[model samples]
Every structure is written in structure tokens, then in C-alpha cells.
Target: MNNLLQINSTDVTVFVFAGIIVLALLFGFIMYFLFSYRHKQKDFQLLHDQKQQIDVQKIELEKTLRELKSTQAQLIQQEKMANLGELTAGVAHEIQNPLNFVNNFSEVSNELIEELKTERQKTESERSAGTENDIINDIEQNLQKINYHGKRAESIVKGMLQHSRANAGVKEPTDINKLADEYLRLSFHGLRAKDKSFNADFKTDFDESIGKINVIPQDIGRVLLNLFNNAFYTVNEKRKSASDSYLPTVLVQTKKLNSAIEIIVRDNGDGIPKKIIEKIFQPFFTTKPTGQGTGLGLSLSYDIIKAHSGEIKVESKEGEGTTFIIQLPIL
Candidate 1:
């Protein structure tokens, strides 16, 4: 009986240990599954957040693309307007000649008519009275007025025809100084047409030794015109509120440096800001308010000079003035 009891007791202890181990293993498995599920949930949340971020970025990119397209369309429209302005200016220049002829001829014709009427009245009176002196004096006076007016009308027509033709096809070795002078006059005339009291003090310093340059006369003339226009615009703005003693001025000068010729256009108007100085040569960069500037004049001028193997540079100080220096190869 004792031996049987001892064996039963040992068996019960082994059974108890086995139950404890099985319960511990079950708890461990449950804990592992809970941790694994939590880890999966965290990973899923991270992926969901990543997708949301990607969606937001896509939306921003689409918005940016739309903005770019809109800006490009506006630039295209501005370019078209600029081209139209150039065409209009050219046409206006052509029409001025004929208009000038019409004006001059009309004045002369009116004066001649008046003189003829006076002579007819005098002749009628003299013939009725049989007075020889009155007839002779009337004939002399009428002839003088007719001759004067006829010559005046002819002169006007000739001038008008001459102005109508292109005056700059001939590319001869022209003195740079003289070409500059002519452009200066034309530029001033253009400004005066727009504003009668817009005169600014103009000065020039030409290097006599620079001599002639090989360039298309019209092209150079146009370049000078652009420069003069900018200068006048700047000076005019400053002189709007300036005292008579503070009259604005522009200085144009030329110098020969080694194998290159340098021309400078300087103005005492409000200078360009530093942040934009580098961007001034870029197409469509303008300091002037909208509708006041086309912004292509300088860019086109820059391209023309570059095609001639030249360079343009600027030096400016805010509130003082700005200077544009153009350097061209002497050869």
C-alpha cells in the first residue's frame, strides 16, 4: 500500500507541472499575437499617412502647372502687342510726310486765291474808270503774290516727297559723331511731338579719333533712338517736380579703348534698383508701369548689338542715375 501511494504522489506532481507549463505557453502565445497585431496597425497607419502626403503634393503640382500656363499665355499676348506697336510707329512715320505736304499746299493755295481776288477787284475798278496807273500797279502786285506762293508750294511738295522716302539704306563709312548728332536731333523732335515743354539739357562728348564704323545706318539710328527715348523718359520723370535750377540733363559720350569703341548713355533720373539691374537685359523686364513701356526696345537693341559682336553693360546708383555702356569691335 505504501509503495503504491508513493508512485501515485509522484505522478500527481508531474501532472501539476505539465499543466502549469501548458498554461504558461498559452499565455505567451496570446501576448505575442497582441504585440504583432499592434505592430501591424502602426505600420498600416504610417502607410496611410504617406498616401495622404502624396495626394497633397500632387494637388500642389497641378496648381503650379496651371499657374505656369496662365503666365505663358500672358507673355505671348504682351509680345503680340509689342509687335503691333512697332508696326503702328512705322506707319505713322510714313504718313507724316504726306500730311505735311497737304498742310503746306493748302496754306499756299489760300494765300494765292486771296491775292487773285484783290487783283481782280482792282482791275475792274481801273477798267471802269479808264485809269492806266491803277491797272499797272494791280498787275505788278498780283504777279508778286502769285510767284511767292507758287514757289512756296513747290518747296513744300519737294520736302514732303523727300521725307517720304527711306533715308538710311546707304551704308557708307560715316563719322560716328555726326550720326550721333543726327539721332539726337531726331530723338528731341520725337519727344517734342509728345510734350512741348519736355526739353532737357543735352550734352555730347565724341572721341574724334574713333572715326567711322561699319554699320547699317538705319540700324544704328534705331539703336540710338531707343537709347535717347529711355534717357528722355527718365529725365522727364525727374524734371516733373524739379526746380528750374535743378533741370535734368543727359550726357552721351564715346571713347576708343584699344580695339573697341565704347559709347555711353548716362542720365540723372532715378536709377534702377540693385536687385533688378541684372534682370534689365531680360526680355519683358520693365521699370515703367504697364502700358507705359513695351519692354522689348532694350532687348531688341541688345540683340542687334550682339549680332554685331558687341556688348552692352550698365552701371547704376539708386537716386543718382544710370549709365549704359555699349562696346563694339573696331574691326
Candidate 2:
């Protein structure tokens, strides 16, 4: 009985020891599992925060880009208005001459009518048939003069309206020669009206065979006006310091190529300096005195030409003269 009791005690102790070891291993595994789960959760939360930050930055960048585009549009419009302002005075002056002619001819024709009625009222013995015929001829001539002047005024008004209106961005067949000539005269008159002493002799040599070309008239006209105005400006400036023998002249020439049409605006004045010539087409670049220029004319012209699938380049010498050549595709 004593031996049996001793064996039973030994078996109970061994079983207790085995149970303790199993419990300790299970507790250590549970702790490791909790720590690994918490570490994974922290990494996932950091990634989510970074994703949210990137989204916010993207939204802010888009908003900034939109604002920048709006600002650029406003500046471009302002430049167009500034150019139109220069053309206005010239349009007014150009219109006035035709108006005066129309008014004078109308008045003369009225007088002729009164004289005709008077002649008709006269007795056959008092009125000579030859005198009646002469009066009628004079009246016919006056009417013709009135008609011609009326048409002239109409054309000038059309041009003013065309220049003032916003570009519709539509391409149409346009008489390039006429367009160039018109702007050249308009620019010349504009300068003259501003400064009574400003004078420049301008000439045109156009290739009549080029015919009408497909282009955005308003945009091309704006380009020509800018160049003509600049040419006149340079010549006028040179005139101020030039000797008595100096003659300020501007010449516009056009030609036809196999696949393109070329327009040349040449001036005899203080040519652009070679150092700054390459920068002329860049935005906000100008040699004009402050407040006298916006520095956007050439930049805009460059853009316009490029939009039309054309090229514009300049050749200049410091003291001799400058020439701008533009070549537009046949399309």
C-alpha cells in the first residue's frame, strides 16, 4: 500500500509540469500575434494619409492652372483693344474725306436741280435748249461724284467695323494685296493724325497671281497693322534725327511660292539691334519707351502666324533697316 501511494504522487507531479509548459507557450504566441496585427494596421493608416494628401495637391494644381489660363485670355484681349484704338483715329480721318466729297456733291446737285426747275419755268423764248442741256450734264456729273464718294465711305466703315469686331476664327478667301494695302494706309494715317509732322512714304508690289487666299482676315489684318505701325514708328523716329536728305520709306511686297504665299514689310529706319532681334517675338519684349508700348504686339503677331500654319521672321541691321517676311501655306 505505501509503494502504490508513492507512484500515484509521482504521476500527478509530472502531469502538472506538462500542463504548465503548454500554457506558457500558448501565452507567448498570443502576444506575438497582437503585436504583428497592430504593426500592420499602422502601415495601412500611413498609406491612406499619404493618398489623401496627394489628392489635395492635385486639386490645387488644377485650380491654379485654370486661373493662369484666364489671366492669359484677358491679357490677349487687352492687346487687341489697344491695337483697335490706334486704328480708330485713322478710320475717322479716312471716313471724313469721303463724307466731305459726298456732302459737297449733294449740295451742288441740289443747286443744279433748282436751276433746272427755274429754267423749265422760263418761257421758250427766254430759255436756250443748249443751256438746258449743259445744266443737265452738270447735274449728271455731280450725281456720279456723289455715288462714288458714297461707296468709298461705305468701304471705310466696313473696314472699321471688321477691325473692331472680335475674331470669329473662321477662315475665308481674302484679297491679301488689298488687305495689306489697306492696313499700310491705315497705319500711316493713324500715325499722322497723332503727330501732324509724322510722314512716311509707303509702296506696294503685290503678286496679282496669288489671288485670294484662305486665311483668318481679322487675325492677318491685325498682324499687318502691327508690322506697319512698327515700321512707321521706326522711320518716324529716325526722321527726327536724320539729315535733310533722309527719306523715310516703307515698302510692302508680296510673292507666290509653290506651296505658300509670302509677304514682306520692309522699312528704311533704325533697324533692330542684332542682340535683341531674336527676342522680339517673345512675350513682353519691347524696345519702345515705357507707357508707349505694351510689348505684346510682336508676340501676338507671332502667335497668329503660327496658328495659321505660317512662319514669320525678321532680318535687320542696326542702322540701315529691317524687313519682316511672312510665309503662309496655300491652305
Candidate 3:
């Protein structure tokens, strides 16, 4: 009986210990599952926040691109307006010359007509035949004057019309020297008309041997006008500070090289500074203060000559003067 009771007790203790260990293991598994679920939820929240940040960044970038494109369009429109303004201003200046001639001539003709009528009445009433002859002479002289002024006006109008015409394709066998001379005179005259005292002594030494070349006359004329205007401005600026004894001079010379024609424009004004020489040809670069210059003149002139398979160069020294040398191929 005693042996049976001890064996039953040992079996009971072993089963009880086994049951307690299984319960502990079950509890540990439940706690582990809860902790893992919490960690996964936190990870999902972080990923959602990151995605929102990325979306926000994309929206900002898209806005910036739209703004940039809008700004670019505005700038292009502004440039077009500026160009139109320049063209209108130049056209107005061109029309003023003939209008002035017309006004002056019309006034003179009206005065002459009234004077002739008065003289004829006097001749008829007093039987003064000599007065009638004088009246005829006066009418003839006035008529000639009118014709002269009319022709002058016509020539100016024609020149302007020719200049304003749409450029035909480049023509060959063009006399470059003559074209240069024409532009030189026109530029000088235009400047003189604007300011009567702006006249300076101009000397030309065109190479008679510079044979005809392929060029567009109107385009080249615009280039020459730009260059000549610069030269004129330089001389005029210098003359302002010059003593009464100083005489302003501008020299324009041309020569024919082996395969090209070179033209030189020299002025006795203050030369370009060393520091800014390299930038002079750059677009929108100018030494003139403020409104005195548009700064596009040289840049445009440079481009035009380069398009014609030519080169332009400048040389200068401080306190001395500046010279621009342009070379074009003789085709």
C-alpha cells in the first residue's frame, strides 16, 4: 500500500510541473504578438508621412516650372515691343526731313504768289510795263526755287523709301566703296540735321580699285550708319571739352587687299579704356552713360558684318583716339 501511494504522488508532481511550463509558454507567445503588432503600425505611419512629403515637393517643383515659363513668355513679348518702338522712332526721324522742306517751300511760294499779284495790279493800273517784266522775272525765279526745293524733297523721300523697302535677296557685283560712301554721307547729314552744330570735317579715301563684291547694299548701309554714328559721337564728345583752337576731324579710308576690302574709321576722340575693350562687342555693353546709347548698335553691326563673311576689329589707346577696321571678302 505504501509503495503504491509514493508512486502515485511522484506522477502527480511531474504532470503538474509540465502543465505550468506550457501555460508560461502560451503567455510569452501572446505578449510577443502584441508587441510585434504595435511596431508594424508605427512603421506604416512613418511611410505614410514620407509619401506626403514627397508629394508636397513635387507640387512645389511643378509650380516653379510654370512660373519660369510664364516669365520667359513675358520677356519675349517685352523684347518685341522694344524692337517695334525702335523701328517707329527711326521711321519718324526719316520722315521729318522731307516734311521740313515741304513746309519751307510752300511758305515761300505763297509769299511769292501774293507779291506777283500785287505787282501785276500795279503794272495794269499805272501802265508800268517794266514792272510787269520784273514781275515775270520774279515769278520765274520763284518757280525755279520751288522746283529746286521740290526736287530736293523728292530725292530725300526716295532715299527713305529705298531704305525702308524690304531687302531683296543679296545682289552680286555690288560696289562696296560706293555703298560705304553713300551711308557715310547719309549718316553725317542725318546727324547734322538733328544738331546743326554737330558738323565735323570728314575725309574719305576710298579705294578706286576695290572691285565689286557680293553684298546686300541696305544691310551694309545700316552697318555703316552704326559705325559712323559711333565715330561721330566720339568726336562730338571730345569737341565739347576741346579748346577753341581744336578742330574735330573724322577720317574714313578703304583699301583692297589680296582677296578682301578693308575699311578703316578713325576719330580723334578719347580712346576706349583697356579694361572694357573686350566687352565692347558684347551685346548691351556701352560706355555711354544712361540714355545716350542703346548698346545694341555695335552688337548688331558686328553680327551683320560677320554674316557677310567679314571681320571687324578695333584698336585704341587711352587719351588718343580709336579706329575700327572692317574687312569683307571680295567675291
Q: Who wins the lDDT comparison?
A: 2
Assess the local accuracy of residue 277 in candidate 3 as a C-alpha lDDT between 0 and 100. 92
Name the candidate, 1 or 2, with the larger lDDT value.
Answer: 2
**All candidates: CA RMSD in angstroms?**
13.5, 4.6, 11.1
Model 2, TM vs. native: 0.83
lDDT of 2 at 147: 89
Q: Which portions of model 2 miss their true places by more than 4 Å?
A: 1-54, 128-134
Positional deviation of 273 in candidate 1, in angstroms?
0.9
lDDT for each residue of candidate 3 in 55-117, tens digit (9 for 90 to 100): 899899899899977864454334323333333433345455556656776676677678667
Residues 1-331 of candidate 2: C-alpha lDDT, one tens digit per residue: 7656445877888999988998988988988888998898898889888888988988998999899778777777878888878987787788888899989988988998899999999998999888889989998998898889889889888866776675456899999999998888888888899889998899899999999999988899999999999999999999999998999999999999999999999999999988899899999999999988889999999999999999999999988999999999997
Superposition error at 18 for model 2 (Å): 13
Candidate of highest TM-score: 2
lDDT of 1 by residue, 1-331 (tens): 7656445777888999999999999999999999998999899989999989999999999999999778755653454344334334333443455455555655655665665566567855454433444555555665665566556555434433332334323445757777677566556655766577787888999999999987655556556667877887888888887777766888889999999888898999888899998888777788889987767667767876787788988899988888989887877
Instruction: Indicate the residue-level lDDT of 238 in model 3.
Output: 85
Question: Model 2 lDDT vs. the true structure?
Answer: 0.90
